[model samples]
Target: MRRLRIIGIGAGNPDHLTLQAVAALNTLDVVFLPDKGSEKGALRALREEICRRHVTRPDIRMVPLAVPKRAEAGNDYRGAVDDWHAALAEAYERLFRDHLAEGETGGLLVWGDPALYDSTLRIVEAVCARGLALDYDVIPGISSVQALAASHRLVLNGIGESVLVTTGRRLAQEGFPQNAGSVVAMLDGEQAFAAIDPAGLEIWWGAYLGAETEILASGPLAEVSEEIRRRRAEARAAHGWIMDTYLLRRSR
Candidate 1:
């Protein structure tokens, strides 16, 4: 039987690697790195850097995998995602057969916590369902939401108030969550915060968090929304890709 370890490397920072994650890295016979194309080459580079800085073993081999792009948006978004994951499962099976030896351990360094907005676990499940013989374990690390709150120097929730984590599309469509005092939005490419009423709201936004290109903006939503949008656009243009997260709070 083969073993797979899904290690969370934290958000864009080499220091974010936990001691456990480092140990896991050292034990792996092979490490799989996903290439998300030229636009996100920096992401791939970061993973390489982490291995260089932490993996002391000389025998560990690094393997690069081309990540398949999802189909363009249509009426069936879930269906499109299903198709994409299926393709990824096939790719994983081939990689394992080619690179991994029987009874050897392999690893995938996932950004942030694997349990967050990531789909690596789901893809692995799909791979197993498709007949790959493997057992896996998850090692948790800091998430973007945690990084955002830490960078902003604020608590995620008020006294006795709850927080909700959701996507940009839902934020744009649902306005704001009525049940929670704080909302953390991820994977929002459309600047969905712009659609909401800025009055009585505060936002803590960060881009390229924990990296050299990091940017932060906060204050009353009406006062800082335009600046955030402008800065986000500028950063995206400069980097060719951006990963950002924000915390929205209702003023008490």
Candidate 2:
């Protein structure tokens, strides 16, 4: 039987590796890292840095998991994603089946917590569903949502009210939740907040969170939205990638 540890290294920062995460890292016999090409090489490098900073174990293997560019999600977004996920499952299955021997432990270091917007757990589940025999444990770490709130010095939920977390597409199509006191929007490539009516809305936006390249903006939505858009675009252009999250609140 093979054992796998899915550990979250948090968003972008090596220091975000919890003591528990470090212990898990030290226990792994092999680690799989996604090589996202040169443009996003910085991401892979960050993961490597986390391993170097922690993981004091001897002779641990680091395997590069070659990731394919996801097909464009045109009209059929879900279909495109399903196709891509299937492709990823195949890749993951190969890594596990070939690299992980019986009774040996393997690790998959996830960004943020495994339960968030990340797809690694889903891909791993898919691999298991394909008849792979393995038991996996998930170790949680700081999420970008937490990082966003901490950086902004704002709580995600209003007093006695719940926070609504959703993607940019849904936020655009469904509008703000009628009762949500706070809303955190992520994976928003289009800067959807700029499309919404900024009246009575406040925003706290952060990009490349938990890293030295982090940029934060907060103010009345109308006033700060353009700056976020400009900054996000410029940062993405400079770094070739950007992961951002923002909180939108119903102004009191």
Candidate 3:
């Protein structure tokens, strides 16, 4: 059975690839790069750049795999995501068949850490279900959580308060989490912060984080919320797609 190593490259920055991740990148027999066609090819290109910088061997193979577009599930979002993971796992297995022999090392450069809001881990589990005994290893890297904090120079949690990390959908359907002093929101297609009470609330927002064209806006929600939305739309239209995360905190 071949081993799969999922390495985190951080948010679009080549320098964010740590030495440990660089070692793993160099060690892998084949690096599987996911190409979401032109819409999201920037991600794959960034990964390729990392390899070009860190990979010493000219003989090392870089494989570009076509990622499947997810089908919309009307309801049962979890089930829908699970089905998509299953399909992605099958795609991965098929790609490995031609590239990997038993016990070979395979690597995937996952955006951000694989443990946080990432489907790569679930997809790998589905791959293992197909009767392939697998050796799995994950190399954690700087996540968007860290990026948000670094960009804003704010800690995720206050001195003694708990922090809640959630999706935009959850933040919208449900209000700000009870008893949480800080909230980090990601994967929000809609600007969910507008639904929260803006009184005494502060927001740190960044789009295309860690990229050359990164944009950041932060201030009291009442003052910056509309600006973030307007800037975000303009950036998305200019760049085709955008990856962003934000932090919200309510004044004590």
Candidate 4:
């Protein structure tokens, strides 16, 4: 039986690697790194940096696999996502079937905690569902949510209040959650916060958290909304891609 390790490398920082993740990196016979094309080259570079800094295994191989791009999510959002996952599953099965050998332990480095907004866990599940004889373990890492909070020096919740994690699309549509003490929006490609009512909201926003290129903003949401948008645009233009999340707290 072949074994796989899903290790979270954290939000673009080598220091955020837990001891478990470092150990996992050293134990791998091969680490499968996804090539999401040249646009997000920094992501691949960070994975390599993690291995270079932590893995002491002699002759451990780093294999690059091409990641398929998701098609435009037009109208049928769920269907489009399903199709993308299917394509990724097919790609993964082929990669494992052809590249990985029996009794070999392979590793995959996830950007953030596997349980968070990442699709790697689900994609791996789809590969297993396709009858791939593989068993896996997960190693959690610092998530953007935590990093965002830490960067701004604030806590996610206030005095037993609730926290809501949602996608940007929903936040744009439903507006601020009625009872949620704080709302964190991830996968927010559309800058949904800008479109929503910023009244009574304080936002702590961070991009490239824990990295040298990190940028952070915090203040009344109405006042800094444009600033965050401007920073995001500049960061994206400079980095070719950006991974960011923001926390919105209701003002008391």
User: Which candidate wins on lDDT?
Assistant: 1
Scored by lDDT, model 2 comes in at 0.89
Candidate 3, 1-252: lDDT as tens digits: 888899999987888999999988878888888877343667877887898899996777888788887778788888887777888989998988878889888898998889899888888888889966779899998898898788778889999888899999999888787788999999888779887778888899988777788799999999998998899989989988888899998866
Clashes of 3: 0
Tens digits of per-residue lDDT for model 2, 1-252: 999999998888888889999999999999988876443576677788888788788799998898977888999999998998999999999999999999999999888899998888899899999999889999998999999989999879888999998999989888878888899999887778998888989999998888898999999998998888898889988987788899999888
For model 3, the local distance difference test gives: 0.86
Q: Give the poorly placed runs of model 1, Cα more than 4 Å off.
A: 37-39
Q: Sort all candidates by lDDT, best to worst.
A: 1, 2, 4, 3
Q: Mind sharing the TM-score for model 4?
A: 0.96
For each candidate in the order shown, give its overall lDDT on alpha carbons: 0.90, 0.89, 0.86, 0.88
Off-target runs (Cα >4 Å) in candidate 4 are 37-39
Model 1 residue 57 lDDT? 84
> What's the TM-score of each model vs. the native?
0.97, 0.96, 0.95, 0.96
- Give the backbone clash total of model 2: 0
Clashes of 4: 0
Show model 2 residue runs off by greater than 4 Å: 37-39
Model 4: lDDT of residue 57: 88
Range of the 10 consecutive residues with the lowest summed lDDT in candidate 1:
36-45
lDDT score, residue 84, model 3?
79
Residue-level lDDT tens digits of model 4 in 1-252: 888999988887788899989888888898998877443677877887888788898889888888898888888988998998999999988988887899999999998789897788899999999999898999999988888988888889898889999999989989998878889999888899999999999898998899998999989999999999998999898877887899998888
